[model samples]
Target chain A: MARFKNKNKKAPVRPVKNQPSVDHITGQKIPKSFVFSRGKLPGPLRDLELDLRKLMLPHTALKLKEKKRNKLKDFLNVAGPMGVTHFLMISNPKSIPHLRVARTPQGPTITFEIHEYALAADIARSQARPSCPKELFSNSPLIVLSGFGSGGQHLKLTTIMFQNIFPAIDINTVKLSSCRRIVLLNYNNETKLIDFRHYFIRLQPIGVSQRIRKFVQKHEVPDLRNLQDVSDFVTKVNRASTKSAVRLQEIGPRMTLRLVKIEEGLCSGAVIFSEFGKEADDAHEEEDHED
Target chain B: MAAELQTLEAAAAPASRKRKPKHKKSKNPSKRAKQKASPMAAAKPRQPSKKMKKLFRKRAREYHSDEEDDGDVEREEEPSSGDEEDFDVRDDGSGGSEGDDEEDGRGAQHGITRFVGGCRAFRVAFMKIMKKHLPDDPLGPILSAHKKLVAEKLAEDDAEHKKKGETKKEKQLAAENGHIKPANFLDAKEKFLIGVATKGVVKLFNAVSKAQNAQIGLNPSKSKDTKGVESKIVTCFFSFIHFVVLAKRRKQAFFSELQKKNTQVSNSRNDEKGNVTGWAPLCDSYMLTSSKLKDWDKMAEPAAVVGQEHESSESSDE
Candidate 1:
């Protein structure tokens, strides 16, 4: 009877394959597979940490290749209306059996898994429902990446990687609007090892006044309406808006691995894809419907 | 198209005269004479037709007005505005002076009539004014035009009320009858006239309500100022146009719009016109026709409903 009790206790323990480092900002674990080389990375590759640190700032502009930018545009055309906040990238073959690196018109691509998470605590608070501060939740994450090459082999490694990257998100919830997105981005070996980057794509929710302010700050225009000045202010404003949209389109597909706070969660939100050419239309579809 | 051709001829004739100076500069006297004659030849014959149409319209009005004596055009106001405005665009300009003369005649006419029913008294006072102002107007053509419109409006109202059941139809049909229905002086007639005459309805309503009180003997002699009389005249004149002129115009527009939609004007023709020749008799003819149609429809529907119920009950028993 004593021997049977000892065997039961022994069955529950899990063995560790590899340990990961903790992220300084989020205080979350960083998987070991994220590091490219054995021990320290050689030469200027060491500066990648500084580059990534700089990129993590909330207001930093995104940089992507032309082919990747086009790929990102296609993904955003479908999923941009979802108002998604966080994107989780899974590269480890252990966790995702179907993920593979494949060739496409854009270039070499990788199929991986991404789990979308919403901040339920914040959502509950916004909804005026009483909720515990520490509680965080998500719906069932979806398999969404598309590419080819050895995918299922790293299931164990990828599982740990997903655990380290994402928060302790519970899946049991009745009102989750977060959806699975199948997206493609240009791939390279360097991207496979250190794929996560932070993106700050300016979205449609940003009002015209805010955009005008951003334009003023960028061009150092003291007065918005300049009659004597050679540059037509109206044309400049339009050009600036179009440029921002192009930037957003390019930024949409570049994969990001940054950890953001998930506090508010709601099933219904205001994310109309139609362009509001008339002021009446904007009045009918209010801005902050997610609340 | 005719107006456009006349305008082009008038422009061309002037252009040729101006070109004569240029012809002189070019030393071309024969060319100048030829250009002058060509435009003048085209313009002279076309000018009289426009004038003749105006003359014809005036004669038609005088002839019709001379023939009719009935002044019950109060109910015709709603559907006449659309056509009258278009048909009398030129006449309205000259008719402005005539309207003023009619206004004075209307005030004199209102002083004599003493009807008791609040709305009836108002309608009588209005008809007296319209008659005194437009004495030549037979009031027959407009009255018939209005009857046609009322028939169509009643048809639409019936169709709409049918789905809601019989009680609504009874109430609406009761409202449609002009005689037994009590005074609703501040009604659609007042509303449509007020919209056409002035931008504000509230001011008109207040003035009219005050005048109505005075007419009803609430404060009779106290409200007899020239200002009161002028306001009353204005209301009566607008009410005449509202019921008589405006309704004719609106009926014209209604029929045109219906034709555009490919729906026939259901009340344009009446069976009672076989013996009726003049406008007043035609108005009587229309009233008889529409009332008969309404009575027939009302009687036929209930009998059919009873027959259906009896049939269904018998089938169930079998």
Candidate 2:
């Protein structure tokens, strides 16, 4: 009778517990992220958000539910308990896709205006054969930041923010097997644009004949119809290198981002830098006048 | 000094005619006496009066406003020359350059020198509103909590590593005794399943490519290869059907095996439930009561109709 009566009652709400996972070797708190869209996103932008979530794998909420009524404060409240270190929000307010990467709670948010983007599926369709294994997204991709070092103060901050968004790997203790993907951010000084590329890391052995390698890896029996002997397959002429090489094959949701604004707080606060704002130049002029 | 005074008098001559001659003559002696008392004021460059300073500031503000409107350059220059004539009438000496230097300094202080437009103006206004609402140091608590979490995690990791270090000596001793940890290997069933899945995928891909080639060969432009293409297509179609049937059979076999195992477990439960049959009687009684309730409405309607007919016959007899 009690069980039946209790069935109509609401379940008790559970309080969120703050328990951050730590790295075993480095003793650093593993950075986790939340990738969600704030406003209405186009279908392609939604897919881009999913790709970004996949890029921050193993520690991100890949299936986070967000409603129109939910505000940034709600995410911040939840982020505190979940130990979310960063938030990547995509919002397309007036047909312009803006991506905001902010450190959780109190932040130096970097907003990027996406000039162009290509989804992973589009990249795959253009390729002859796209290799995407199930384990490709099991670990977070390694971030390779380039051309950001020689820029201004805001660019330096952007470089640091991107570097810390993913988990930091101590080279001496890091395992090579865990690195299956790489996210490269290449900045072009001339155009003032950042080229974002996600690539799959492939390792191929050197000095291996193509026919024998295919047989070994794919278990495919090569045709020996024109060969004098089976030994001919093994002794096929191939370029031999002393060391095995690592190859990077782009498996991408590629993006070209122009840094539009940098705010002192999460999506708010004083504008530290802006590409389109006259205050940016005005501020520089003010500094010069002061000097 | 006498030559500079003559030049000053020449610049102020037009102003004396505009004003009364007697008033200009009365004020000139007092100005000369003040300049004579402070010879350094005369030696130094002439400074614009407060009125002239205000006019220069206004001209600068107008220039910025015109720039904001993207006004004509000639229009802006025309206003500047008229203001300079007003400056000549108001001061005894030419102070146009000094007024400009002072206005530049004041403009920088007031943030009015630069032409702020578009998003920069919005940003400035946004920061002002944000400052009004947000606390001066709102990040303190959030930052402290983050730091504390990192410190706690580091402490926990240190303890874990200490424990691991304690176990390392025993592991080394065991290794010395030739009882090292065994290498991890995949289970045979898992390995075989992986191999089977990979080979199956490769075969399907090859079959698909062969079909595509056959399709290309069957194009109307390649009429000479039609016969060979037809045969290849037929073989590929048959192989595809074969693979589908094999997959279907495998799925059926797996589900049937699961069903068999489930029924065996249920039958064992039935064999043990001979003494506990309370549920059967309870279910039978519940079904009987439900059926009786379902028939109650029909049974009551006939009774009410018979009563109504009797009542009608009684009234007719009366």
Candidate 3:
């Protein structure tokens, strides 16, 4: 019996801790809704951080994509009459896999570990955020590069972009009395639209206004006078806004961003994506929601 | 088609001149702030009748005369310079004299009577003044002709009003007021309609768009089958699909069906004697008809709803 007890003690003691468990891959809250969310390490990429490994999986990537789509649909669904605030979105461009670029009040910033993927982070830092769709934008951070470490930690970074420029858009809720656009969101949020470089390609204020008016007319609505009365309501953006537009400064452990605008009524935005540890606020949120 | 033609003719006539319903309100000589019960504050202080002015001044020499002493009755004074100023903002600017004289002439000749509903005593006072001011004689025949011309001109003015109304409709559709801007065929079908309220897609709610959008489900079952039948039955007033089928015989059948709907108008055939047209009652109804068959057709109900909207649009265009 003493020999058996000695054998039990002799076996290598596995490390144990009293801290709360976390989703190792996302560094996000894994709620009771999750059936099996624990991360699996890959043979070759295992040495990379767990967050880096998470990006490599087809399933997780798909899940993240679905997560965004559902959020978009949910937002469009709920944001109709009642209002929404702090609504978050994660957009995936066809070009990048690991990048979780988000449009926010701050300029566009990237999130990634510095040491683990030194070469990839360095290259990303060198590239400038593109600026054609926008006369100004933010990109390429060095701190995001600095944060990358080979240790198996899950890190997330959110980059904020898209400044709402509909002047006084937040001051009042608009009711489209004539048209049947059942999915109209608050004007402030509409300016938060994504990938709109395609929508304005052949756009004209008069023509677009006419088409929308024609829809009202077809509905047998008697008149569309108020909108017509203000012919100068020509642009979606308030080029005259006074607020600052966001610009990207640095990326690494955290993103440093600033906003500047040329006109008085508009705002520029920034986005920073940083990976938080699993036992952080998000986990607390998950716990709070669980009960 | 004939009913539509009459609406067109009515719309095409020049501005008609209707005798303006001269419900002329007499002026007030007293200049007082408007009280709800007030007519025009009494007019221009009455130039003070010679004897009244003498006594009023004599009373005032004691140093004060309350406004009540003006002896200004709340009478419906004849339309005067002051009354011109009181006319509504769409002022004809002819001043009170012209508007009143025209009113007096027309009212006296046509035996026009305007009934005032508010303030019984005030209205009674107004009638006394109306009878007193009524023109002593009708204006000469030339005046009558001129007045008739004006009334006809006013009626025709409706056509002009509608012409401006068409352009106004486009603006109004942009604006959203209540005048039923004339409609056209393109407006009969809208591109986007509310689909299922839960589904954000118009394809679910908008029958028209649903029928048109191909990437969605195959055309609704009924719409697919009915594509070959040639008629304008428009069966699916509430269906979630819209398909236009083109078969000619069906249109002829539809006309026959419509003919059956208006039996009296369709049945009447009057036989007129050589020169004297006798009042032979059609269908011998108590709502005796002396009007021609064409006029009876003009009053047809289906034609009124189905064609009036189109008639207004076509007439406005012409």
Judging by TM-score against the true structure, name the best candidate: 2
lDDT of 1 by residue, B65-161 (tens): 7543322232233223232233233243323322222222222122211111222333344446557643363223343325677767777888877
Task: Quote the positional error of residue A139 for candidate 3 in Å.
Answer: 16
Tens digits of per-residue lDDT for model 3, A1-291: 454556546766669432222334434331111011112212222222232222212111212222312433343344332222222221111111122222222323232211112212332344364122221111110101111222222221221122211111110121111112121111112222111100001111122344332332243222334565322432322232211111222111111111111111111122122234435524423422221
> Of the pair 1 and 3, which is ahead by DockQ?
3
DockQ of each: 0.00, 0.02, 0.02
Candidate 3 on B16-47: residue-level lDDT in tens? Answer: 12212221233442221231123234221223
Instruction: Evaluate fnat for each of the predicted models and list the values in order.
Output: 0.00, 0.00, 0.00
Candidate 2: tens digits of C-alpha lDDT, residues A1-291: 354457767667668444346788888888899999877666678888998888888789988999988888899999997889999998764456768899988898898888777777777766667788979897788777767878999899999999898888765555555777778787878999887777777645456677645654465646778999855765677543433335666675878899988889887777798887686545533422221
TM-score of 2: 0.43
TM-score of chain A of 3: 0.16
A284, model 1: CA deviation in Å? 63
True contacts kept of 2: 0.00
Worst-scoring 10-residue span by lDDT in model 3 chain A: A194-203
Which of the two candidates, 1 or 2, achieves a greater DockQ against the reference? 2
**Residue B270 lDDT (model 1):** 22
Residue A73 in candidate 2, Cα distance off native in Å: 0.8
User: Which residue ranges in model 1 land beyond 4 Å of their true spot?
Assistant: A1-41, A49-163, A166-219, A222-291, B1-318
lDDT of 2 at B285: 62
Q: Ten consecutive residues with minimal summed lDDT in candidate 2 chain A?
A: A282-291
